[model samples]
Target: MSRYPDVYKSWQSNPEAFWAEAAKAVDWFKPADRVFDASQGAYGRWFAGATCNAAHNCLDRHVAAGRGQQPAIIYDSPVTGTKRALTYAELLDEVEIFAAGLASLGVSKGDRVVIYMPMVPEVAIAMLATARLGAIHSVVFGGFAANELAVRLNDAKPKVIVSASCGVEPKAIIKYKPLLDSAIAMAAHKPEHCIILQRPMERAALIDGRDLDWSALVDDMRAQGAKAACVPVAATDPLYILYTSGSTGQPKGVVRDTGGYMVALMWTMKNLYGVEPGEVFWSASDVGWVVGHSYIIYGPLLHGNTTIIYEGKPVGTPDAGAFWRVLSEYKVASFFTAPTALRAIKKEDPTGSLISNYDLSHLRTLFLAGERADPDTVTWAEHALGIPVIDHWWQTETGWAITGNPIGLGALPVKPGSSTVPMPGYDIHILSDEGHPVPQRTLGNIVVKLPLPPGCLPALWNADERFGPSYTDEFPGFYKTADAGFRNEDGYLFIMGRTDDIINVAGHRLSTGAMEEVLASHKDVAECAVIGAADALKGELPMGFVVLKAGVTREHADIEREIVALVRERIGPVAAFKTVRVVARLPKTRSGKVLRGTMKKIADGIEYQVPPTIDDPAILAEIETVLSNRPVVG
Candidate 1:
């Protein structure tokens, strides 16, 4: 028997009591006056009237608990051939020193500091330091285009900008200082000071009055024995602001609160991830993403678990075995990554040969998120790793998993295409366009009930008015997930795809995700994407694009024919899945999400702006070329 039922039922019976019980694990300077006050903020506030410091909870508490010597961060950068680890005491020392450096630069409580740096230990230090001072930090992805960075700069209006001289990529060294300089020049809200970490790989020329050297400032503070004490802040205070990726103009900055976020992370570390203190947990994501914000930096540290800061790819950065090597060397207990990463590795090493090269004895569960994890990839991973391949569902707004298979409560049965049951706080519903409940196993809009659990975005940064319009107004009394899916009779969630990806063909709604799943099941197909292309008669039609596995020398035409037949047989002919194109690769975001919307626009001949988050702008041109010269097969 699983304990999940009782745990979930306990939450459903008394949500506030459930959360209040979880809050006891965290060391608070002052307890909450009320566990929850429904009349507080946009929806409601958790731990109202509480006082806490996030940095102290993540560092000082653990250090004071005698885990000071335990490794807090394991930084492994295959790209740089660099590997290092920092203990809790050492990490806290660095954060305090850096906090003093920021304090000297006039950064204090409520002030916003924008961090634009690569996946280095200093980035984590900067975030913790900002939190230590009761200030908010916004981390922009390193090496972002100048214009995109400028947009974030203008919106965030940071007082102090922390960045690096450059970021090293597999193929090239990206000079970040120049891009940072251009962004600063373009933005109307000029920051008072810019602190740049000059890497030996590429040194940057700093502006005399405006720029400061990161090492010099930290060294000066350390030499003087200067350390900033943690500043107590209200539980409702914003801890950080993370802007949604790929936003073009006037980005939506998601604000995460201090007390609620801390409590939630502590709970998730134990319950959702089944991770205990002093264990190694790796979330193979960048600091710029939500996964990094929660898992990589705060979650594991808050729970006293050693977190991995990996600066490498799933395939490159040496070879396809990079991830396995890190897992084996670090003895990672739980591993979390995006599905696209697994697909990339599976593409390069189709037989899972590279995975066998490393000893992943300590590896327990493999968690997949970011985008929908197709059944094919999930099955392949499960068979390859001999562990539960859990696919959870969430977004940047939620800041944590909405639905997941909790490893801590009790391991649940593996479901290939389902994102298990909803977590304790989330009350999921599959609703029709008219806002009525839909039947089980029927694809519909997915939404969560009001007063979303703690750790979710309280509101958009300085734009509380826009929050409702963007998220809530569409579905009254519910937070519109915008993704279409359905719940099975057994309560498992099957997220088909984004709501827009559901195409209307001859008066029938068909799922592109379902079609993609079918296409991916083909033996030769390594990965695939399905988009609803415009059709004059049917209104819309499903078009498939697939990338073949390595060493597959079969004819593209033959593989394409098989893919169409598979979809036709599985989903019936009403899917209208006719066009099949074999491409060198599918265009993806830096975070590895397929750019399906952009692909749809290109397929329909609509003008589209290149998304700032695209990994390679040249891939779009190649996709366009492939679409123009359509393969006359399927």
Candidate 2:
């Protein structure tokens, strides 16, 4: 039985007591010795003595109890249009054999294995195998360039690397093996073995000794009579070290231990997505990011739910209709995606009936993260998909959503642009620039206070001093989110945007998001990116690059006038962009955040690496052309 309490309570009044109850909610074989360990480190441990296998909790326990015949996975091919339904019995078999194959190659407990493959079934198998054997899995996004991949591989020094020959995206067929070969070629300290998947089968100039065919490798293992088994490891043993995207600089590897990650992750299942037993949930995020790690991969699976692990982009091979078709095909009860994808696809098929094309009657929740979800997207989802869009706030460092609205449980007055409330057990206080706590309604950096979150990484792996300075030491007493926000008089948390994203216009500090949301609402604009451009006098001013929908002409004067008027109507004239360049599209990452830093470099004539992450690299060139040809208007 479950004693689920009322929504808005003093969840933090007794933090340890509240967490202890949560730790018991899931299946735990051996209990933890302590619930909290302050002396251990900041954001101290919960379930400190817990010794359990994550793979068993997710797969084995349910399957061993006659639930093996149940549907465990529902996969759809990106191009072939084939459907593959995996039962728990079959999934367990795959995990077991894969674990054995890894062991055969000398990948054992405490060793690192970097997974650089697509979102195929094998990727999940590799992850489970690593977990089952007590090895730390560092799964990097397959699409990252060789430079990025090599940096992570060098950092972790994984014993093995698993990559695909090639992969797919919306606008291109990514040949990843070359990058893998290039990385291995350049590695001064490389992994002992490299396994390659043969889907979409294309090979490059091969480095024969380092790489081997993946299908041949795993197939050989299943023939070896591998059975489901979990190696006993310390509760404190690391499970994975997912590296953060290096939007600023070199990526930092985030270490998630066995006990803390599992405990914090399980709560996310029942609470965040409102994931119920046997529900079909789907989060449209890559396993590369934290959202995928928490919601898409771990949270849903932990709850014994059949979730969707999509391979292609939301807008690939088709338009916005593609997403709806999948939702209709799977009858997804919970659908999640980033705001950029929502903005992009909605323009391609704006009738919003694309949602109706599918049988979405089962859908109860639509979750959005990676970037702030605008009110228009929420209203659109409600009217179109017929589900409430629950906007949440979290970051790579935090590991899971820190501030978000729970599903139907705590409905404070619905603010159009606010995330509404801090999640239970997360203490949030707005702090001034100097780190002093600020009064309500005053915009400041949002900081998470003492009694830190367990889900939040124990520390950036091998960079404890880096964690102290970047997150903890700088602020003295709080984990400064780097995100800026303010609580209204009614206590709703309004996310103002990242402090780095703020722009100053004639001495007035303005959030680029507020301005962009108003611009995004323009009838002709499909999507727009607002970035802070270095200005001579005002320090920094807002510059926008917009992508208009089809049939919407590039009328510089008309569109510019309308946007300026829209800003005045919505906010004021001062908030208007001094420059609006109507272009084909904006540059964005795979997780769907606009690459403002890339745009900033372009604006400053500074050289930058246009990501291999975007669906179209040509769009950046289009934006550059738009900026070059535009007439200066001051």
Q: Which portions of model 1 show Cα errors greater than 4 Å?
A: 631-634
Listed in order, each prediction's TM-score against the native is 0.99, 0.94
**Candidate 2: minimum summed lDDT over ten consecutive residues — where?**
1-10
Output candidate 2 Cα RMSD: 2.5
lDDT of 1 by residue, 1-634 (tens): 5688999999999999999999998889999999998998789999999999999999999999999999999999988999999999999999999999999999999999999999999999999999999999999999988998898888889999999999989988999999999999899999999999999999999999999999999999999999999999999999999988753567789999999999888998999899899999999999998999999999999999999998889988788888899999999999999999999999998888988889999999999999899999999998899999999999999989999999998888978999999998999888999999999999899999988999998889878889888888878889999999988889999999999899999999988888888988999889999998887778888899999998999999988888888888998988877789999999998999999999999998899999999999999999999999754332
lDDT of 1 at 441: 91
Q: Model 2 residue 325 lDDT?
A: 79
Candidate 2, residue 219: how far the Cα is off, in Å: 2.7
Every candidate's lDDT: 0.92, 0.76
Residue 367 in model 1: shift from native, Å? 0.5
Looking at model 2, residue 138 earns an lDDT score of 92
